[model samples]
Target: MNKVILIGRLTKDPELNFAAGSGTAVTRFSLAVTRPFKKDETDFINCIAFGKTGETIAQYLTKGRQLAVTGSIRTGSYDAKDGTKRYTTDVVVDSFEFIGSGNNGGAGRDQNSYNNGYGSSNTGSDYSNSSSNFGGMNFEEDMTPVDDGDMPF
Candidate 1:
């Protein structure tokens, strides 16, 4: 029930790290999301991706690139050196999709073709010139001839 979907640009390149004990990949970045009604206003949201999802994000995405992120909001609190309590809120990314064409070495290729799960070995050729079929229906196969006289309008 705590799902969040955001379409925004990365403020900077994602930082990728590994958990010391588990060696799990962790990627962190900030997203600049503009307000729908207020053009001049924007929000910088912190986001984190774990495991293979994190690795893919760090590998393909960069600053100024648009992304569609699906995740959940997580909030936490910590004590600072000044004895002040600081609260933090961030999106824990479950999945993400590339939004637009960029200089990420995958131009003119399908971005969504890359698998987001672990052990995905997608190459550049794997996404090149890919096409999507809407609703699993091929328009050419579903067409039916209609007569002009059948129209009531």
Candidate 2:
């Protein structure tokens, strides 16, 4: 009964690595998730996914991409270099879904093709920065330029 679900955008591409001992694939990434009511705040969640899921994420997901994480919340502690004990909280992801992707490089990089994650931007400008519209917006025309002559000079 330690399940947790999160919808957010990847702050950056997941750093794929293999366990030194087990040689199992693992991905470490941070998700920028915002509160439902809060306007100027966001929580950066550190996540770790393993095995095929981690490989898939590493292959497909990228910075600012949306993703849905279904996993458990795990907290741990470590000793700092200053000889002080430090505590950390992390989500050991069991499974995840690639939500929407931004206009970087991909066939699915459209406005409506937003990944499943929620926008966690702390900037007060707009929430349209991510693949999904966390700002509660409807669909709009594709911002990517085509050969249209509608420029008003």
Candidate 3:
């Protein structure tokens, strides 16, 4: 029952590190989620993803890329060097989806086609040419004859 979903843009490139004992990959980043009603307000959230999810995020995502994350809130406290107890809250990412065009190498391609899981190896391709068709769907073709019975309305 402890789940959180957020859509936002990355504040900077993800920082990838490995656990010293187990060598497990961990990625940390911040997200700037804008308020729905308040145009000038935004919330900065700290997020962390582990294992393969963390690796994937570090490899393909970058600063300014939009993303949707589903995860749970984790809270903890640690003793600082100043001998003060510091409390921390982080979103432990369970899964994530790429939103809009990524800020990485695959430019001029359909951003939605880049959607993938944490373990997926698809790196995506560039489609800079105007004549290129997406998955064989021709935009110029007349398909008015297709039935509209499937419409829920």
- Measured by lDDT, the strongest candidate is 1
lDDT by residue for model 2 (22-103), tens = 9999989998876666745678999988876677678767777766676788898999999999998889876554444443
For each candidate, what is the lDDT?
0.67, 0.62, 0.66
Tens digit of per-residue lDDT, candidate 3, span 54-73:
88778777887766677789
Where does model 1 exceed 4 Å of error? 103-110, 113-153
Candidate 3's displacement at residue 100, Å, is 0.9
Model 3, runs deviating above 4 Å: 105-153
Pick the winner on TM-score between candidates 2 and 3: 3
Evaluate model 3: give its lDDT.
0.66
**Per-residue lDDT of candidate 1, residues 1-153 (tens digit):** 887767677888899999999999999999887667675677899999988778878877777776667778999999999999999999998666564554354343434644344222333322323233222333235434223232221
The order of the candidates by TM-score, greatest first, is 1, 3, 2
Please report the TM-score between candidate 2 and the true structure.
0.67
Task: Give the top-scoring candidate (TM-score).
Answer: 1
Model 2 spans > 4 angstroms off:
105-153
Model 1 has a clash total of: 0
- Measured on C-alpha atoms, candidate 2 has an lDDT of 0.62
